[model samples]
Target: MAKISIPTRTLNDGYQMPWLGLGTWPLQGRQLTDSILAAIELGYRLIDTASRYGNEDAVGAAIRESGLPREDFFVTTKLAGRDQGKPYVREGFSASLERLGLDYVDLYLIHWPLPLLGRYVESYVEMVALQQEGLIRSVGVSNFLDDHIAAIVAATGVQPAVDQIQVSPTHAQVDVVEAVSRGGTVVQAWRPLERNGGILEHPTVTGIADRLGVAPSQVVLRWLIERDITTTPHSSNPDRQRLNADIFEFSLEPADVAAITALDVGAPVKQDPKTWEEF
Candidate 1:
């Protein structure tokens, strides 16, 4: 295995966030605990989890048992769909903290816009309050569209430190990324492998990997890094996890980057933020 030097992105809020992280979704029980421990052992400092994942307790347990200082890790948890109002923002964060067995998280995010509920602005206001009180180091949102982000900033006069969204070659989310960038908010790509879209096998990506003598996944991840977008690709296999984090060793040429960019079809495999209402 190659030696990996993880890079950090300085947020507008004056805090540093790791560019690569371990995403814990659809993981539970021993699988969750073991993967987290393995990731930490492999030098993964950022662990992304959420209340909806139903694994915060397991995540907390693994962190406590790791014998690592809390400050060494960047822990991020989200407020669930059910917890999307001004009234529940603090309550939701408190529950997440208690479950994670932590005094404070490095980042807290609204899981979704929940636009129908029409309270995300209010919820974000409370997140700002929590940040002021030292409960969270940064505040952000997941699956938020450009309009949603603009609304939050317009209302509170504070831009989010990050915007976690589903992005890949197939779903570039160019508009959203540019919009978030205008506010100096870093865009974090989830499902960066495009879930089951077979992005790794796409000729454009694999061709680049072949020329560069790296795995197809490495090629894709490197492209995102070159674009200055943070990505967290989830995998339970320890080897795969290490491979995902080992992207620092190679660089994709400008032509290869352009080829991958041309692969974007402007569609998302998951729920659209405009209509997604999962609780």
Candidate 2:
């Protein structure tokens, strides 16, 4: 496997995380473990998973099998929606840690706001305690908008280290990115290529890819990186994994970035943060 350097973005909490990482959602069993092991072999250090994903154990097992020090890996997991309350934060985080077989996670996130239930702020209080106890290096939220961010900060003085959200050429949430930036929270783009991936075929992205002699997906990933939004792109194939990380080496011209950024139609997100239930 060819290796390349993946850059890091320091969080508000002073923790450095790889700007590019392996997104391990809906991937489990030997396949998940193998993919993680393959990623590690390829110089990929960040592994993203969630309690809702139900594969923390596999992620844990893969890290141990890799024969690398636990600190060598940047592991992230979320608090399940079912576990989104003050009463559940401690236990839920403990369960996830036990499953991941690690003493501390590099980052811990509240999977969703679940606004109607109105417990995220309260739950985050407990998460703060968990961090104080040295269980997590950083605490943040996902699928959160400005309002959700404001609430968390108003209730707790600490800001989130990163806000993970759905972002792509077609569904660029530029406003959300700017909104969170005000609080010193870094934005991490999850699913930078929308699930369907039709955006990769668009003339703008393809043209840039063709001119640069790179894959269309690489153009898109680089565009997001240029915007300073870290990406967690998932690929099960080792070749694809290698190709994804290849973005770091090449430069995307200013005009090329603008053309790709123009592709944002403010497309609707896959799940509405206001109403989607992840429990």
The prediction achieving the highest lDDT against the true structure is 2
lDDT for model 2, on a 0 to 1 scale? 0.89
Deviation in Å, model 2, residue 200 alpha carbon: 1.8
Candidate 1 regions off by >4 Å? Answer: 1-3, 268-270
Provide the clashing-pair count of each candidate structure. 0, 0
For every model shown, what is its TM-score relative to the native structure?
0.96, 0.97
Give Cα-based local distance difference scores for all models.
0.87, 0.89
Off by over 4 Å in 2: none
lDDT of 1 by residue, 21-135 (tens): 9999889888899998888888888899999999999889889989999998899999998888877878888999999999999989899998987889999999999999999
